[model samples]
Target chain A: MIVDIHHLNFAYRDSEILKKIDFTVKPGELLAILGPNGVGKTTLLKCLNGMHRASAGTVMVEGVDILKMRPMEIATKIGYVSQKNEKARLTLFDAVLMGRKPHIRWRPSDRDLKIVEATIRHLHLQEMSLRFIDQLSGGELQKVCIARALVQEPKLLLLDEPTSALDLKNQVEIMLLLRHVVDYHHIGAIMTMHDLNKAMRYADSVLMLKDGKVFSHLHPSLVTEQMIESVYGLPVEIHNINGHPMIVPKDSTQNLCC
Target chain B: MHLHDGQIPEEYRKYIGRKFVFLLLLCVSLLIALLFSISSGAAHISLTDVVSSLIGLETSKKIEIIVWNIRLPQAISAMVAGAGLALSGAVMQSILRNPLGSPFTLGIAHAAAFGAALGVMVLGGGIMTSNSMGAVQITNPYLTTVAAFFFSIATAAVIVAIARMRGTTPEVMVLTGVALGSFFTAATMLLQFFANDVQLAAMVFWTFGDTARASWSELAVMSIVVTITGIYFFCNSWNYNAIDAGEETAKGLGVRVERVRAVGMLLASVLTATIIGFLGIIGFAGLVVPHIVRRIIGSDNRFLLPGSFIGGALMLLTSDTVARLILAPHVLPVSVLTAFIGAPVFLILILRGGRK
Candidate 1:
């Protein structure tokens, strides 16, 4: 397993954030986390990378316990893309090149430079490589951030709302790009997403959380209409649109008969 | 193991080459400025005599004394102090992620002033006597500098403590710095209020920031400190570049953010404290030179650090030269000229609104 979390729990002081979460993902697999607001989606991602220490249980990545690893050590094995999308004062090329920090010696070697250039090319950000990040649109900035994460060459990738700021076309492109990266690099990607239909369509597996508890953890094909309604506290219908499952909200005006 | 030799894109190659040319120009200009400052002092030393003296060739005794004893040391001191201040300013701005974050803006200058005032009123036995312009000769210059260093570092400690308690948010740090500055300014005012005429004269002169005050010994100290610290800042250039992104992003890039911030702030404060201790309060070389250099060289700290140093030295040398020549013989303080020059340029930069 690329990531193996068993009975993981996290808390902020006295308030529990994640409760007994257990999940395992292999390389080249995309695991999409679905949850309502304030349901510990982001907290779980932080725990996997040891940004927030787990209160109980173990998180093992590549058969090594993450709690024992140094931040620099973990950084080489896992790349995390945060949701805060503020542009830094850096050219796009330099920003992506920064991802190689963990692997760099005193200075960047020829190999490091080649890897960065390759990643930027792969992302098709060559046009804006010299432009400052502040000049880029939201979609372009998101892609740069992803490219930076990709250049880390980690075994696992974690993304927090990667597509939230994107338009429809950009969102689809980003998802496809991520999927392609996972397949080509043979790395596991776990991302927290708000869009249920997108998650169902793109993710190999889905983990749904409700009020800091695991509501369901299953393959996308195994998720049912009842599971969505119970976890989200809303009535919804799941229709198979082509080969993908599409979620449609039921009529709110329909009253439940006593 | 050669990997993709010459794979660097044409644009990036051009970027590196342009930065190199820019750096070269700054170096040439700095050299020219130093030569000009050395040659144009109160004594009538021609450029030929200056060059002859510089190269250790034969020159008249009086010419040698003016160039070597008086003007060369003063110009070198100005360059060293300016480089130190500008380097500190660039590092602070990058680490704090605030454009206005500099030694002057962060209360280090005010603290140094207060310390110098304390040295004048208390340690130096309140100067000799008050003259017509309230200018009195200080009894002990070394004590004044030591006291200034002590207080500036103390102020930095307080600010760092506050940051530790309240998080290193740019808003918190800037506000705390302003508050500390006001506190130190008020403390200096209190000292001035109770001081005698001689003490007041000494205190006033201490704050005027004259480059002529830098003796050969003080210049030596400043040069050594600046060179060592400057090299240290250069070596950590990539770490600083990572920090410019954001704290969390820096951490994700495996930078120890808290450690880097604390150490960077301490070194910056030390640089500020040492220079301001010797030179008194030469403002805006720290504040303005780094911004101008950033506008020219882009925000990469690797280039920004050295660029700011050269640019800052050039600015201070020019301003000091103007201070010496504009009034001629009755020279004004270099700080006055830097303020006159730096304030308007800073205002224009702000009004133009191209600043990152």
Candidate 2:
């Protein structure tokens, strides 16, 4: 197991965000987490990245407890891409170059530059590299962010709503790029998304959460409509499209009405 | 859109040329400062007289007194305060990650003002009746200056501590500084009110800032402090670059976020403290010079810090020269002159920058 979570529980202030969340991921696999908003989707990713200190649980990555590792150590191992779409002061090259941050001190090294350049090349971000990050369209910025994380050269990649800011085509491209990262780089990925159909289409496995508890952990075939309906608190219709499950609205107007 | 091209051709060229221009500008400003500091003062000393007096030529005692006792030290103080404030402003902006961050924002200047008020009112009155600004110790001049420095430093330290404990939000940090500044200003006001007639005059005069005290001894300490700090900050300001990338990015880059931030603020604040104690609160030089430099130099602390220092020193000298000769025998306080010039210029810069 690349990551093993034993009874993870998390809270902020007086409210619990995650409860007894047990799951695991294998090496070089793409695991897409699906859940309603505010259901520990981002929180789970934070837990995996060691960004959040869990209230009660052990997260073991590669047979070592992630909690025991320092944040820099964890950062070196897992590159995390957050949802900060715009911090305009940073240029594209600098934003991407920041991925090398975990590998060096406050100053950038020659090696750091080489990695940043290579990552930029790999993502075909050579054109937008100098543009300020805020000036870029959402899709371009998302790609730039991914390139930044890729430059970290981490074995595990964590993304929170990587496609949330993107349009449909951009969403497809980001997913495809993520897929490339998993397959070509041999990096384990666990990303959270709200698009169930997209998740089913792209992810090798699925982790579903309902009210902070793990609803189920399964492959695309086993992630039943009933399971999603229960977790999402609404009636969801699932249809098979070329062997992948596409979830749809029971009532198009309201959020998955039960 | 891409990373391969790196800095655009213009920025790369700018990165090099700006440094040269900065150096050239620094030299020109220094010469300008030296010329005006020597030429323009209360006494009608000829340029030749100022030069002769400076190089130990046989000049009259009047020329000698104006140059050596009056204008020379004042010039040195202006140079030191300007450079010190600007450099600290650059550091503060970087550390705070806000464009508006400055030494004045942190309450160090206000604290220093209050300390000077105290020193002039309590210490000077109780000891030196014929005392004046920069009038060294019949008692401990250094002690009085240091007391001012430490009071400001302590206030800054408290602000830093509170901000760090509360998660270092920009809003919280800035608001904290604002609150401290108010507290210090109120205290200074209270001191000014309670002071005796002679003491009141001294306190009021000091608040207006006469750099007449920038004696060779004070300049000696200023150089030492400024040099040590300049070198130390030139080395450490890269952490500003890292943190400016974003706090988490800085942390990922192995910058202990809390430690670096606290250290940066403290260093900048301490420099402000030391400077204002000797120079007596030269206002707006710190705030304006750094802001202008940022427009040309960009926000990278490596570039911004040193650039602002030179820019600031130049501004101070020029302003002081104008203040001195503009009023002839009645010398206007340096702070009033800086406010007059700097405020308008800063307003215009901000207005133009806002358009962008």
Best by lDDT: 1
In the range A22-64, model 1's lDDT, one tens digit per residue, is: 8899999999999888899988998888877899989899999
Q: Point out where model 2 deviates above 4 Å.
A: A1-22, A55-66, A85-90, A105-107, A241-244, A252-258, B1-73, B122-144, B228-232, B354-356
Give me the displacement of residue B318 in model 2, in angstroms. 2.9
Instruction: Identify the CAPRI category of the predicted complex in candidate 2.
Output: incorrect
Q: Each candidate's fnat, in order? A: 0.30, 0.07
The residue pairs in collision within model 2 are: A125-B2, A126-B2, A127-B2, A128-B1, A128-B2, A129-B1, A129-B2, A129-B3, B134-B213
TM-score of chain A of each: 0.96, 0.92
Residue B116's lDDT in candidate 2: 71
Chain B TM-score of model 2, please?
0.85
For residues A1-258, what per-residue lDDT tens digits would candidate 2 score against the true structure? 778889999999899999999988887799998888888898888887666789999988888887888877887777777776436455677777767766666567666676776677678886766666757888988888788778777777888888988899999999999998888877788999888888889999999888888888888878776898788877778887777677886876374344
Candidate 1 regions exceeding 4 Å error are: A253-258, B1-6, B128-136, B347-356
lDDT of 2: 0.77
